[model samples]
Target: MTSRLVEHLGPSNISGASAVEIADRIRALILDGRLTVGERLPSERALAIELRRSRSTTTRVYDILNQDGYVSRVHGGGTRVALPHSGTTTVDGDDESMIDLSIASMDSTPGLYDATVRSLPRLAALRGTSGYSLQGLPELRDAVAQRFSARGVPTTPEQIIITSGALNALNLVLATVGRRGERALVEQPTFPHARESLHRHGYRMLPTPVDVDGWDERHVTDTLLHGRPHVAYLIPDFHNPTAATLPDSARARIATTARNVGTHVIVDETTAELDIDRGWAPRPFSAFSPEVITLGSMSKIAWGGLRLGWIRAERGLVGRLLATRPSFELGTALLEQCIAIELLQDMPALTAHVATRLRDGRAAVAAGLARLDGVEMPSTPGGLSTWLDLGEPISTALSLAARDRGLVLPPGPRFATGGVLERRVRIPITLSPERTTQAMERLSMAWSDVHAGDEPRTLALPHAAVI
Candidate 1:
């Protein structure tokens, strides 16, 4: 923020300079750390008032900072700091503090490996092991098809293709069905990697807005028809970042719109099974649009390292996708496939175990965030993170300030559709109870500090990354 001893640049002084010069000075102040991270800037109106410059001139400077990532606004929180250089990882290496709310994913079910080991004999029972088939292994395909078929969507082994993980499945489907430079429809504030993947392939993005009630049917439908999109990437169950599940009505509508408009929909159902509430599973959205491409990953339900996922599409499309899959890696480990096969067979017990842990973990984190002052906990029934609407967007600064206290969080833009969703931050359920509480406490302190105009202080994570 500008010092209280404001420089009231008179009309003559203001007339002597341009907006670009003011922006340059502010930029230098931020880059050199004189302004400090998470420090609020004088509002555009205030700056104009002090500098005797037009509001447009001051606004231009603020816009420059936003583009440079020096600052951003939260929904209700005033503009504060943007993501700091927290080195982006912890000493543990695997957990990125950016991936807050560790409670989002439950660890693998206990009997998963045991079940896989037990299945080896059955796999060894196969007479001959041959080279990779354009189609995945028949036995595994048949077993998976049966599972999906039971959910009211009949599938044949020929329609399924195995890939290293859901990412590969998504890439192949997009490669096959998506055209470069064409708009790909997606939800606002979507998974960051999904957006990156689309960008990597040279496809343009068309992000539609979503809220607690679900997707605006008109907005999505209009985009598909008029935008001339090639792919619709959707996360139908317990979506990442937002933790929202598209209702069945919205699901059916989206699927129908995609199919009718000749847009291939890639549905990512990685978190389909994590609903701790145990509500009735909405029929697989793919069931409503067989022409759509659907992707699934065992990583969320099993383990991230498993690297097992599958694509369900019509048989010919499956072959086309497989031909492109090798551009990435050869294949997922044969062992991981065997593991996923066993997990499916043993899901009854595995689901029970995962459910217990996630349910408790959610409780632990929710309880903690609720106690923080100035934090407005939004009502999200059953996804990993609580969208704590702190009634402000200064979250990015608070996040940076919390770094000195040891917690790292993703800024709101990471999930934005049209570069909106500023006031929000996602807190996944992946964190354990104890660590999450400590993290929240630090966040509260950061919030208090920044809102009160104090210099944002850092937190010490026992293992926080030092840049």
Candidate 2:
């Protein structure tokens, strides 16, 4: 599993060229698998010595590599290669294993489409066309409500209003609760798309911090009780990026606080179902505050292509959301609704399959990342991306380095909760076992470089944040 990266630009010949040229050489090495996963690269000092170049020139070279996504930087440590991904191919035709730590959610089952057609008769037989109902199709409402009830919170069809996806559900909640200029509180490093929706619709932001260590209970309690945000978006179940779930007690406390401040707490349970090891069955924060609007989706459980999500709310606000549906998404596809119902009926089988695959994938990535030195990851099993503490400040450079190798990964700021994590990255487990292993090995190389103080070695980025 351990290998040296010597694809091109032999160390002795790595001098008197531009930083871009040096970066290209390093990138080729990674792509060609000269740099294996988790291998600690030579220090900046050692590399400069090897290449017989000034330390500054060596620094610029690493900076270019960092920007291009071939390596990661750690403050006071050195740099290491980044985890590889699907399209990482070298000029020599050698390919680096790719780890997809970019997007959340795994691909869903294939039979889902056929399942929808089978359920159409009951809807079509309504003696006429099932015209648009602000409230979703009666059948889907029952199915969605039943899903919540089955999960523990008892509810009826009247409580469910199906929408386009979790994004739609959040929009409805924000529009009903927030007005422009009033602050809408959200967890820091939340789903970016949701954040964009909130911003585009004219709501100001008040970010509450949360991470893999768990919800920043005190900060969240303060934000809800004192900040007076019109609405507080809560992802108490398996948070994205950080993958931190609110413990049951904290969930209740935060809900109580939201009620005290009159902020409608909007709970997004998108990734709560994608846990690989422990059951991701965290109870909704709404259990403590039924006044809270809880958003659920089949996107992660099934496929993202299925654009169906639902909101469970108190009847009054639910009606407002229903009225606004035509302005945005008319409704969850009538046919998709039918298909979802069929999928729901056979949910146990799909659930078992998902749980099994996720378990294997999580183990594979977690084990691979653990092999790298100076990298800290939470040992507790949950969520899609592994929250990694890289022990240096060149996360941005690392991402750049990764890109040069044709392995695009999310930068540290992509997951910042009010701007604290920098020497970190989210190594997602969505890739196959072999790919994840390869990615981790590259990561080790990047970290080795970071520890050696050669990360972010480019002059163009001296004025820029290296993330």
Candidate 3:
């Protein structure tokens, strides 16, 4: 963990900026959960040598951290990350010092509180049953199935299985389909948690690159043919982090290619309903091929705390998943299912509400980024985040600087398995216009601090790479 932290700190050439810079990097690690409460930090001498700074500078940085309540040092005990009450804390925990941009989820939708209150009467009727539904509540499944059908993909209740969320759905699929050491093809810069889930289930990852303009069909097809992966995971619409929506033609070609290679394409549509400026809604990927498995969630569209997501697959596949699900857990929650049913019943209104918020957020963030001289912000039509180019492979440094100003951002490399994309960072637009403006202000300040020693750098490219 210490070595990893050192790598994330990157190199600092400006000697005068070493102490504060090192302190900021350590604070960023703690806030990002890379460092936790009661975790002992490396010795001051060792860390100073690793950061290429003098021991006195490192000792002063530690002194500053101790003064700020970010770390505690006992007489004989080494320094450790402080507890929440002591000063440092997690994002959702008590501390309000830092603003979290690491998560790309939204707050509760407008009608959620009312929907929850209204669900009580309906939920009271289900108190008699055991509430252990291996598949899901019949009404909820029917509602989810109808949603897919309304989107032009024919679906039935028998083809839908509710899970905890998108990650749970992905885990179930991987558990059922993946084998140890087998290749799992995925988008180069896909969701970090999804990639972690695939890795945890023992599948070797095979990455195919994506860009702001969207996927390269020829490359995707060639990789699928050559890699012969067991599972291919893709986020077709308003992809996470990159915010690129795959074109229908490319989707069709990729689906056909995967089918030819006997690979199951798992299409994640968690961000599909967040369309702010995309003119038309494309048909679900399953519409192109029956082999395609689609995953949807209320987390992004409605609320992250809802913890409800569903998988749409063939009836036979659904049965297989249901049979295998109990081995992991009994079933999804009943109350959450009831809430999802209410949300699904009024999805049109809910989607409209979120669309308005996202539109304003996108505008505000875009305007804010424009104020910065070197940052490059992409034009994202619909998604929770916009991928930004920082002109050089200093994403880690910039993130550390942002942390010093009380803003937390996940660096670009977190989204990819390789270190090739260290020049980018994903900024969430799910925040309100006010918060978005503030975050951008802090980000600009951090950028200035990082480039204070050198001239501001800029890169002009045809399209931003996905990962």
lDDT of each: 0.66, 0.67, 0.79
lDDT of 1 at 98: 35
Writing each residue's lDDT as its tens digit, candidate 2 over 1-467 gives 11133212444344466766667556544543334445677777777666677788778878876766668888976788874343543411156333445655667765576676777686586436554446677877898788787777888898998877788788877766768877888887766567666766777778877767877788888876777888777677767777777888888888888888888778888777766566546676777878988898888778878888889998887778777766755566666677788888887777676666667667777787676667777754666666778777556557645543435555565443322355677777666677667766666655555555554332111111111
TM-score of 3: 0.81
Encode model 3's per-residue lDDT on 389-431: one tens digit a residue. 8788787677666665667777776676644476889998899
C-alpha TM-score for every candidate: 0.75, 0.73, 0.81
Worst 10 residues of 3 by lDDT: 458-467
Ranking by TM-score: 3, 1, 2
Task: Please report the candidate that would top lDDT against the real structure.
Answer: 3
- What ordering of candidates by lDDT runs from best to worst? 3, 2, 1
Which ranges in model 1 have alpha carbons more than 4 Å from their true place? Answer: 1-104, 119-134, 457-467
lDDT over C-alpha atoms for residue 410 of model 1: 52
- Candidate closest to the true structure, highest TM-score: 3
Candidate 2 residue spans exceeding 4 A from truth: 1-100, 110-117, 120-133, 279-281, 417-419, 441-467
Candidate 1 vs candidate 2: the lDDT winner is 2
Q: List the residue pairs that clash in candidate 3.
A: none
By TM-score, how accurate is candidate 2? Answer: 0.73
